[model samples]
Target chain A: MQMDKNSYKKYADARAKKSPCAKNCVCAFLFGGLICAIAQGLKELYMTFLKEDDAGTLVSVTLIFIAALLTGVGIFDRIAKHAGAGTLVPITGFSNAVASSALDAKGEGFVLGVGAKIFTIAGPVILYGITAGAIYGVIYYIVTLIMK
Target chain B: MENLIRIPKPVYILSSASVVGQHEKNGPLGEYFDIVGDKDDTFGCDTWEKSESEMQRLALSRALNYACMKDTDLEAILAGDLLNQCAGSSYGLVSFETPFLGLFGACSTAAEALLLSSLLCSSHMTRCAAVSSSHNASAERQFRYPLEYGGQRAPTAQWTVTGSAAFISTSCKDDFAQAAHNGEPVPVITEAVIGKSIDAGITDANNMGAAMAPAAADTLLRYFRESGMQPSDFDIIMTGDLGFEGSSILCDLTATEGLDISAVHCDGGLIIYNRETQDKHAGGSGCGCSAVVLAAQALRGIRTGQIANMLFIGTGALMNPTAIQQGASIPGIAHLIRITADIV
Candidate 1:
């Protein structure tokens, strides 16, 4: 059907109502910002609690992992709905993805469910790393042996 | 910075049904070709069982014909489509022994795949990259079922073409690298910004412009701010098919943002089919509309030195049947790619 100019104009006008506005921005700035700030605070507390030299790094990673796990419980989806990309734009989002998958699958069977599912999002990274590493290692061993 | 990398080879582009005559009949775009009568092919996606995957395979085969490496030589395949699971891309890539990464960015999937591939190449993470996109009318049938297997459409709703596009990116010594920046290759991506339109409850497909315009504006504005470049600094600013309305809305929105970008802007939907010829109501749909235009038209323009400093923005309505079923509004996203000539 040929779109008449008048109808097209009406469509265009109706469309204008759906235009993106700063008010409807989906990136939950406040909530995501609060979560990040809290995570930082928790990291500091953990570092101070542990006197070990590497405690800061260790504690931060642990906290990030735990936060990601909470996000995986499907709770983070609600938070993300409210926060839009705010929840997604952070490292915490990645954690949430992995944790959520693992939690959802945990009911299936621990080995395949909990263990395998936790790495769903990060699986590609790990797979590539291991495959590439093996290939590089084999090449290195061959080259060294031949040179000797 | 003086050394530049060229995508080592050219990738051949192939379409399943290249309706090359004005009165071509019985394809996804058969009706369109009959009306338009241009020598251009109305790539019909109407008949293909698995249109997306079929087109993807066809496109990849075409690329392989032009590429130096055999199918086995490819390290991995980066592919996507405007479908759930990126089904077309995944199923197509599955045939190859190489690993695959499925991506979805609505219409921007082609560029997204390329960008990721380029990043991997620039970082020496991969030796080669291939990116492709496809659309099939039958696939739309399974998904949208727009008209009753046969029915009339409002001019606002566009007929999705069944077509696919592919390109190969390889690392090669850059000759154009030297002349442009005195030996330094310009970055393929000087900057990139992704923006999404917040859903405002508009459902009519014709008004996609209003739904997607904000994302386009936000990204374009962000690109200017981040790159510290003005609108005129680039030769052309191309947007993925926004039809006539979205294009206007984008222009208006840009003006509101205090950025005047009227002179160097265009849209894929408006340009794909000559309105005088086909009268494609609102314009083209499906991922192939933008992908084919970028590969066949935009890249040609850049290669011949007809254009420089091109900003290609691919827009997508992040709406699904599920969302529409739930009465949720449509949210759109636009991804930008900055490509410059490697003038030797």
Candidate 2:
């Protein structure tokens, strides 16, 4: 059916009225800042709970790994729904994915099943990092050696 | 907040069509190429003319072709275009027996169609709805052309091609659900962040990337905050074409924001017409660029479980003579759609 211009404008206006918030605003900044704060809190908790000398340094890294793991298991996603990226952006999200995948396979047998499966999701991340690092390392070493 | 609403169902982008490269190959629109100076020998006529009725016929036919719909099915069309009165869409939709709705968002028209169609299906307003957009080369020519008949064109401005795209959204039935082995549908649109691209203080066509980049970054960052999701939560985060310049600028801006979500994002415009094959100076634009990619590639991947969850972002440059005359900057807008696979 042909919609008259007035009706069309009404629809367009209605659609615009229903659109999401303008991107630049105090709320966006405050909320986004809040997510960052929670992530920092998680890092501090990991450091104190682990009680390692390098705890502070390791906490952020560990949390990211844990978060990625939970993402794999599908549980970090639930946490994310509640905390937003405040929970997911940290290292714990990665760990959740690894742990979930391993747990899923625990019934099969520990050594071959659970132990081997932990890396299913984490493996790619590790592989890419190591490979990229190695390539960069080699390039650096070559440049240094040539200068010498 | 009362005005802003969200759709609860996944709307599949079934098919998209583009006349960008097609115009260069052969068409009545080919004659206009002489004015633009076939510099790279790869110019696609972005502008063309067809009677309002003719445009409607071609657009509807393209939409139907992609939908794979039969004459007897109970479906409806949600279509839009840039022309005054939306003649292209109205005429095209008239031929169909199905109910139809006409809409306009200037350049943001297609996403509006998709959003409205998804809402209709989620609320059970209809079982299936089709959304499409079209831009005629000749019609755009008359709009931009001078009264003197011939005018020198800026190298950076893109030609608008006539094209149409459509998708079918069907209800999730019990039997289909059982057979598919799906999860609770990922929220199709938990949140959306819309941004208007204010003229980033530039008018040169080469700087469109800069003009549209802020809008892209603004919507994406907002979506992340409101939805409480990290970049990694999504298997892929796709943006409608911003061309090469805009894509890089967007990436750079996101990085500067400390968001660090770059590993999984891509622009639809950069991928649509392979630069190697078509050798487009920048990349495809117009409504069909994103529509086609979502239907043919992104949605297919999601349905097959290739990606668990995806975020599709469509961007548009809000350019009008009034704004330009007022010396106001061009503003841009972006809308995000999140789609997840449901087996059942």
Q: Which predicted model would earn the best TM-score?
A: 1
Q: How far is candidate 2 from the true structure (C-alpha RMSD, Å)?
A: 25.1
Please report the TM-score between candidate 1 and the true structure.
Answer: 0.59
DockQ of each: 0.01, 0.01
The TM-score of predicted model 2 comes to 0.55
Off by over 4 Å in 2: A1-148, B1-6, B9-76, B128-130, B139-143, B146-156, B159-161, B174-199, B276-279
Tens digits of lDDT, candidate 1, B145-251: 31111112344555465456666654444422321224322224434455555554566554566567667777787777666788898888988767776788889
lDDT of 1 by residue, A86-145 (tens): 665566655665665555455457898678766755577668979999999999999999
TM-score of chain B of each: 0.79, 0.74
Tens digits of per-residue lDDT for model 2 on A1-148? 0123344224323322121234223344554466567656866777667765566676566556655554554455454433433443335535554665565455457898778876765688889989999999999999999999
Q: Residue B84 in model 2: shift from native, Å? A: 3.1
Error of 1 at B142 (Å): 3.3
TM-score of chain A of 1: 0.52
Write the residue-wise lDDT of candidate 2 on B164-246 in tens digits: 55565554443233222244332233334445444455443333444566677777777666666789988888877677767
